[model samples]
Target: MWEKTMPINEVRELRGKTNIFLGVGAIEKIFDIAKEIKEKGIDKVAIVTGKSSYVKCGAWHYIEKALKENHIEFVLYNKVTPNPLSTQVDGATKMARELGAKAVIGIGGGSPIDTAKSVAIMTLYPEYTTADLYEYNFIPTKSLPVIAINTTHGTGTEADRFAVVSVLEDGKEYKPAIAYDFSYPMYSIDDPKLMVSLPKSQTAYTSIDAINHVVEACTTAVTTPYAVMLAKETVRLMAKYLPNALENGEDLEARYYLTYASTIAGICFDNGMLHLTHALEHPLSAIKPDLAHGLGLAMLLPAVVRNIYSARPEVLADVLSPIVPELKGTKEEAEKAANGVREWLEKVGVKETLTDLGFKEEHIEKLVELVFTTPSLDLLLGCSPIPPTKELVEKVYRESL
Candidate 1:
């Protein structure tokens, strides 16, 4: 008898050291943010973003106007790409430091935001490379301020304390995620209006990423009731609104709910942490740097669900039933639940399997090896319901293919 609550129509300012401005017209808050940082004596900031989303999504205009009005100086680093690289982070850090930039503003999705976090930390220790930080070669305790301007409804890097970057070592790329207390942004903006311009493919991919976040968060070993509650709402919102947003790209109402779903999903993983899906997806994107993070996660999710269901059947069944109504909270329904998830992904236009995305049986072994060898990924596997064995890793990758 529980009915879903309607999305709020008005903009609201959420307060914290990491203040968030969300909803329609929330990007305008950049004016206030710019002024606040300027008053703190930070006159120069480095803007780290991809080549175009910041401008294409209509956030760059407001951000640029705000900085100009506040007389704040900013240097642009627009070379960040999907599956962001440590070399790019290092390049940006070098630019920011040389320009005397005191803070970093990350625009677009997780890639740029994560790059900004890495840049913020690396700016302080000019001696350390991003690989050093991601590999735990040094424990960093401080970073320049980071402001996240989220233009996509996925990769809640805006609200979490984690950043993922790929580093090249021994002629192979190793993508590792780093978490530090200072990785949290000092300010974030999540304006649904900015998301209205997202393309159909990205819309589908990003929402799938949000769903995967909640799915793994709810089933991780550290999951709590609070995380479970947020996870269920995230799934429900994505189920109801993602289709509407896909059908009509300009539907602000749908964008609002999906954006909220992505944000809370970020919080869920921030609190509950993540497991196999994220652990596995990182290696996929790391190996194929062109693969979209959300798409990779989508490809891996069904098999991961089947593998983890027995560990927390009742919880997973409840959280996932919004998308998979056939889930009956019984151990016997694991396969059914996972199949239902795959069906839902297909419904959302994410029909590519691992092999369809160019992975082969020969690649499975390397994928499994990366799962164990990638820094911090093994730690994520430790939080899984089952043992983190090479056999199990190969089985999941093979099944996904």
Candidate 2:
């Protein structure tokens, strides 16, 4: 086997002292983390969160009450969206600064945590607009400490430096809002019960999002031995546990495995990152902000896999074969795994097509233009093994229609 060279080493490995708040019922952990922040003499703290599964599952109130009981002067910014905007983040940073919050707590799912990261960065540099932060490496030298609690098992945005804010630059919106800060959470709370109250539809969407993270990261770039190992583990756990976690929502063990798999996928992609599926999905989510990201992901992913099918088919096919059994071992078998993904997504009750979600062909041109013209498009789309052009992007959009 020829040695695989690292495509990019620009991803910084962020290390920070983290006070991990956790448990199946870790209300105590919340209290402990809050008290620690207070005793450390942190001046002010702000909590940025929103109504989501985490709110329904009840971590939001628990954390909120804990902070209030501790008498920590803080502000609350909860007007965040599923696909959060740069404007909202700027608003949050202003809230934090006006309140004089020194530390920030992120509750709910990826959106709020993602919101918190942007707010954390913006607090230190109040002079800059959110647009100034969208450039690849324009972040300030330091930021306020942020703690996150992941109440969902997907899109592990809480544990890393990458926060992709979809903001319009010159009349176009793209993702990857900030990458330089390595906005590593000052703490992470992974509570399995947090996964329990999720409705089945949401459970499926979030789980597949995690699964795709593993598949895309494993196949996106040249895999290092370590990255591949975590990717494989993520795949194994997801394959074995996703359906069970969905079917048996009350099982803490299944919840734990799925949550760990989601985080493993996060760590996997944190090292390897994502490709066209995510890049394309960003616009779909932005255009239809009502769509859960995982739902948009499910809608666009199979098309992305099929689009990339013929390019580097052997390696991607093999990496994916086990998840869809028919693709394992044989060349034809390996090559067919991409289609199997689409089939499995439908079989598992993920939305089968764009029409299922009420989107029509009329939406294609706008989505395609967004995909091409969005800020940071050149960077994210460039990650595909077979480079995609504006035309190819339209083809994927039309096919999904």
Q: What do the candidate models score in CA lDDT, each in turn?
A: 0.90, 0.72
Model 1 ranges off by over 4 Å: 1-9
TM-score against truth, every candidate: 0.97, 0.87
* Clash-forming residue pairs, model 2: 44-102, 161-182, 161-183, 327-333
- Where's the lowest-lDDT run of ten residues in candidate 2? 1-10
Candidate 1 lDDT, tens digit per residue, 294-388? 99999999999898888889998999988899677988888998999999999999999999999999998788888888889977898787887
For all candidates, what are the clash counts? 0, 4
After superposition on all CA atoms, how large is the RMSD of candidate 1? 1.6
Residue by residue across 186-205, what tens digits does model 2's lDDT show?
87877777778877887888
